[model samples]
Target: MARKLPSRTTSDDTKSARTRERILDSTAAVLSRKGYSETRLTDVAEEAELQSPAIYYYFKSREELIEEVMWAGIAHMREHVEGVLAALPPETSAMDRILAAAEAHLRFSLSVSSYTTAAIRNSGQMPERIRERHEAERAKYGRVWRKLFKDAADDGELRDGVDLLTVRMLVIGSLNWAAEWWTPRTSKIDNVVEQARQLISNGIAK
Candidate 1:
């Protein structure tokens, strides 16, 4: 059999994909530093080391760019949490799974990934159409949490009278809030995770 090789179009497609990622990364950095209202395509282009007009080749408008950045952030967060859950041992208890998920959430939020930080801080400022698109991505992440909580409840790990939906909201709300106040200089991520785990376990565990 003859060896297969990538076509010229495939190579061009790879380059185009890389350029789009570069634009999104630059946009995330700008959004984190300048916020959504203040960030401009010029800033993204400068950060990406491309001409301002080049950004439009990948994204049609500022709204489209911001929306893509926000969607990427949410998707990244969801993947991180899912990876953590998947890595747990099959024998892991429901409480342990919840703790692992919480730790993963906190660690990602505190890391230098500006995409998630931008998403956390600026998502609400997006235009209604963009916001709706972002929310759809966010809802997928929410379902992951709901499943974890629902499993915990079914296993009798959660306290009576505790609603799984409310627990999901409260847990995610607390984790998201850490993006605002958490700093490596003032507090450690592990310590913060431990504290959160303890508080949650005490509240929800039977």
Candidate 2:
């Protein structure tokens, strides 16, 4: 005879979800502080105020937990970026709007250091489903960049013969890599943001 499976009541499911979120949040903190190379499951458990074994009840392994945390971070980033882009004035110059978007992205990334770091470093290790989710959001971000670059080129803002793809990757890659060493005491984000804007504008300015 086949065995009967247990059912989850509504309240139990809600409580379970809350616990899982707490663990994932704690894991993000640990990953941010220690990075993927040095982070441990026990450290995460301690951060979550749970026994190490209890963690397995939610996540089957360290890899799985990391994946979950990475996805969460990516989702948060996507929402913030999409929201900012959506709020831009229709008549804003593409170059100026792009700079504003860069500033917003850097601000959000630096403010949520752990999540940003986790999302960037663990991106390659994400499961296919998680990867697709992130890719979809990233594609939306790409559209904004494409529009900015194309408009700038068309408007005689960017230098003739400039490769838009190369420019886009360099500008965005540098900004995304900022989460690695950004610190509350010494990192001047606004200045860095302006510098990044100037760098891109000067490099490709017509």
Candidate 3:
């Protein structure tokens, strides 16, 4: 099953900021549950409990709003994986870091927020401008994994002669797929993550 988004309000935040967040959050939910082609300003308005015109005050167009949510999603995932790696001990093996990141990525994809799921779901199908900008954000997220793969290579843990970019793509591509078919009733997120970690650990050896 899909995960519900958590509130992001703050004590000092303006009501406007909170409402904007609600709009973005609702849009992400719609984009994840419904495809981008099926989502509309009115659907978001109804979900956010606001007038359709109100959305214009926050975002210029549907593409612009969707772009923001997608960007936010990649940013969230990058920060999460980076934080998990940074918190590890200095002597933690590169392979261990990769496994830790695999767990983090799986959990984020399966159980964290709809923003990332929507980002994954709608990737490559956005407007040209939106796709370009989102691809830049994607490149940034890709760099995080590239570093993980590179570090493993430096440690002599990654398979020799394999391209880091290819490894990054395979790892991220496979993990991102969990968003498509995962349901809570079928398997727990932890089980899915564990299987992914083992696959990565072995696949890196292949």
Candidate 4:
């Protein structure tokens, strides 16, 4: 008789998926606290409350786990930005749309999730291959902002002779840097958003 293949039920698959998500969540938490070099599979496993070897079921190595965590953050941020842009009223001005996008980006970056903060702070320490992969995802994320700025410039909303690329970089760099110093107790997200909006709009508004 031929050997029979093992089978998995819906409940089994659901449990497996949940476990994987838990592992990823724990990975993000550990990375945010301990960083890449100090973080180990054992730390993630302890955080996840599973044996260290169990992590292998979800990821091959520590680097792979960290890469996945970073990718998840990028994906979530992209979806949020796209949704915010899509929800704007059809009659909204280009500058308004840009400000709205900035607000959304800043809000999400400051939220409870530390995935984005960890990724931004520790990307330089990632291995060469993993860093390249993360950068590829970041490049794709940059295109969204590029299009937003390009559309505004094309619509004559931006000041004459403005370099769209430089404007995009400065705006994004400012937002990303908030991961380092922004705190809810000292500065409100709304206040930061308005300040950024005023800065960008003043510089580029026609």
Candidate 5:
């Protein structure tokens, strides 16, 4: 057989994909800092180090870019945290899985990706249309936590009479809140993760 070479079109497509990802990443970081109301295409262009017009090549408008960023925020975190949980051994205890998930959520929100931080920071400020569009993603993440809680209850890890919904609210709400104030200067990320793990474990320990 004759040797074949890569197509020029394939190379161009790869570059285009990278550029699109760069735009989304820049938008996420900008959303974390400036928020939805203040983010501009020019701001993202500067952050991505691309010409202002280059952004439109990937996203049609500010609203479109923000929508993608918002979607990426929750979607990535949910995927990542679920992936973490899924990797545990089949015999792993439900409470251990839950603690791993809590750590994963805290780390992702605080340091892993600006995307999740942006999501946590602007949960309620997204336009109604965008919120409606991404609502499924937020709900999917909610379901992950919900299932973990349900598993704990089924496995007898949760304290008797504990309300899964209320404890779920406390745990998820506290983990999300860490995105707002956690910093390397304030505490080691590991320390924060450890403390959060303890809180979740203690709150639900039977």
Candidate 6:
């Protein structure tokens, strides 16, 4: 007779998922501050308030644990972008969508500061799967800029001879880099939003 298999249920799966999430969250905190090279399983375990051996139950090694954390962070960023895309009104112009998307990106990045910081700093040490996931999310988000530029061009909103790709690079590069230095108390989000809107709307022409 074949050996009996363990039964999987909604409750069991949910519990397991929660535990995995707890480990990942703790791992992100450790990796974000100390980075992959300096981080250790003990650090993650301590941060999570779990025994070092407990970590092995979810991940085989520190590398795997870090990979999961990076994966979760990127997944979160993608979800934020997708949520913004979904919330947009169907009749809204692409330019409006772009502005809204920028605000959303800024809010999410700032709100999840530690996770974003960890993702950016430890991205190089992440596994191939994490890298691929990050690229996919980026490509999906890039479509928003492309669509906005195409619509703007169609509506004659852009200045003569303005390159759409250049505009995207300038705008997104600025927004992403803001996470590096923006302070919640001093550089408030509303101010950042307005400044970004002004920068993009003012056009990049010399």
Task: Report the number of the highest-TM-score candidate.
Answer: 5
Clashes of each: 0, 0, 2, 0, 0, 0
Query: What are the Cα lDDT values of the candidates?
Result: 0.88, 0.78, 0.87, 0.86, 0.89, 0.75
Candidate 2 lDDT over residue span 1-206, tens digit each? 99866666877999999999889989998987877767899999999999999999998888778877776676677677768877988887777767777887788888754676677766665657546656765676678778878888887787888898998888888878887767777658778778877887787776
Q: How many angstroms is residue 146 displaced in model 5 relative to the true structure, after the best TM-score fit?
A: 0.8
Task: Please give the distance, in angstroms, between residue 66's alpha carbon in candidate 5 and its true position after superposition.
Answer: 0.9
lDDT of 5 by residue, 45-137 (tens): 999999999887877788888888788889999999999998999999999999999898888888889988988898789878778657889
113-169 in candidate 3: lDDT tens per residue? 899999999896687877777788889888888888888898899776878887788
Listed in order, each prediction's TM-score against the native is 0.90, 0.80, 0.90, 0.90, 0.95, 0.79
RMSD each, Å: 2.3, 6.1, 7.9, 3.9, 1.4, 4.7
Task: State the TM-score for model 3.
Answer: 0.90
Clashing pairs in 4: none
Instruction: Name the weakest run of 10 consecutive residues (lDDT summed) in model 2.
Output: 121-130
Ranking by lDDT: 5, 1, 3, 4, 2, 6
lDDT of 1 by residue, 58-172 (tens): 8899999999889888889999999999999999998889899998888887885788988997877887878887899999999988888888988988889998777789888
Which TM-score value belongs to model 4?
Answer: 0.90
Quality of model 2 by C-alpha lDDT: 0.78
Give me the runs in candidate 5 sitting further than 4 Å from their true place.
Answer: 1-5
